[model samples]
Target: MSANCSWRSSCGRAVWRSSRSSSCSSRRPGAARPGRTDLASVPNGQAPVLPRTTRLFQGRVHAASITHIKPPSVRAAVPRRPAPEPEPSGAEPPLVATDRLRKTYRSGDLETEALRGVDLAIRQGERVAIMGPSGCGKTTLLNCLSGLEDPTSGTVRIQGTDLYALGDRERTRFRARMMGFVFQSFNLLPVLTAAENVELPLLVTGVRSRSAREQALEALRLVGLSERAEHTPAELSGGEQQRVAIARSLVHDPPIVWADEPTGNLDSENSQDIMALIERLNAETQKTFVIVTHDPDIAGRCHRTIRMASGQVVPEPVTPRAKGRARAAEAKR
Candidate 1:
């Protein structure tokens, strides 16, 4: 061994390691060996330090990191932009609203105005019935309000959101998130089980399959159809299928439910039972309901009746039946 036990700048070790020898193999694999070392100057040599932004040839030369740090003066001179304030949504009612809503259908220039400048507002938690004759555009109004179809003109606002202003995909997502529909036809798939049919909306909204199935069962229980959860739509009766549709609507727990002749296909007994179920749900969930129907008894059950004529909301005529029902409702209140 050499008597000069010099400290190498590369290894920073007092024991000398020759560049060509493998005997001192204590260093990392593939590391570059020290070419040369000075015995006399290493014991007293000062650490090499470059400027703040530049490093020396080897990390051991300075044994310090190189980085750019903003000075306190520069940090103090810069100003941050203020965050914007959110707009107030309290100006309008948090319910369904429409202003001068119009819908015109054109079948090769044979134009038909389905909704003629209709303006109405349905308050939150109100069960509203729209009664009209055939071809009076009651279903059209429901479609436009629920984003199932776009109107030719005017604005429809639901929960302070401009329904038509959103893109097709965004409006679909918003409708799925905010509104539920109970169609005149049960609209249940023939092959899927009751629970599977009810859980479609939850699955569409990206919920887990297990959680969606559990929620679907709970909704079915709410509608008194938990016993038929595994049965197909064909296996159930008409009333039971309608009850499953109601379960599907409530599975999402939407704030608004648009029902288009929900009991149109059922008999009088079934119709009464269905309407009773609807009233119970409305009372329990406090959900806003807009039902389009031709039955006076169903209309009598609502908070108010909106009569339509020729695609327009006409004045609600106070028939003797309506007067008696109104007085009864007042008595209950």
Candidate 2:
């Protein structure tokens, strides 16, 4: 029996020879000592057995974890939308009101109601004509609207500012700054030249003479009378004088132009010419016009016509000319 054998390998089983003397007491046949392999064989016929295998040299095993992550990608910044477009500079504002504007006149004991609650609105750049027979308040309405006469009742406004609230001096200044007048009669001065007649309004406003003359010439040029600038109104024809009058009205570049029978005294040929000129100015310059006339032909030429009868505005059917003009404009569009 080898007592000092190392327990190194799996086969390091203890081997023991039975004691040489059978009398050697208490000795097992294959019993191993402590810190050594078990080699004991039972005397009651027990056989040697091996111990079971276990995880002695193996390292610890951990559960695997799974996590989700997103990858980076290319992105662009979105552009902001542009703001909505603004209204045009010379455009008319929408109608705010059409009130009962009236007027009354008393001649000694006889009373005349020139207007019976006339409800109307004159927007910026609106071309409107006042048409009717005599005593229809056409001129009276024009006078009130142009701030030349005060209304008996009701109100009139320009861009929401009441015209009647202004004092006489203030009203005069306002008229010079905001209105242009064209009378039925050729109101030109016989003494002043065409340019000088055109410069009257500016002169009244106290503009410098040189500047007034310059503006007057330009206005005459617009009416195609630049060649006749030095000629007096008496020297010019009826049409030319009317053009000079128009030039005078335009000298101040007022927003509104009030024509009280501008062509009432002119023949048809000259009347057509004047209407054509007015139409051109309305289309090109976008100036507001309120023309008074007794001619349906003249009224037809305007964008809108309000017919008056016995001091009251009466509704009328649209003329063929207006229909034709509307259709032509549509076709052009």
Off by over 4 Å in 1: 1-94, 319-333
TM-score of each: 0.69, 0.69
Compared with the true structure, model 2 gives a TM-score of 0.69
Candidate 2 local lDDT, 138-174, one digit each (tens): 9999888888999899887876767788999998888
Give the poorly placed runs of model 2, Cα more than 4 Å off.
Answer: 1-98, 323-333
Number of the top-ranking candidate, with TM-score as the measure: 1
Task: Give the per-residue lDDT of model 1 (tens digit) for 218-316.
Answer: 999999998999999999999999999999998989999999999899999999999999999998999988899999888888888888889999999
Q: Identify the leading candidate in terms of lDDT.
A: 1
Give the TM-score comparing model 1 with the true structure, all chains together: 0.69
Least accurate stretch of 10 residues (summed lDDT) in model 1? 46-55
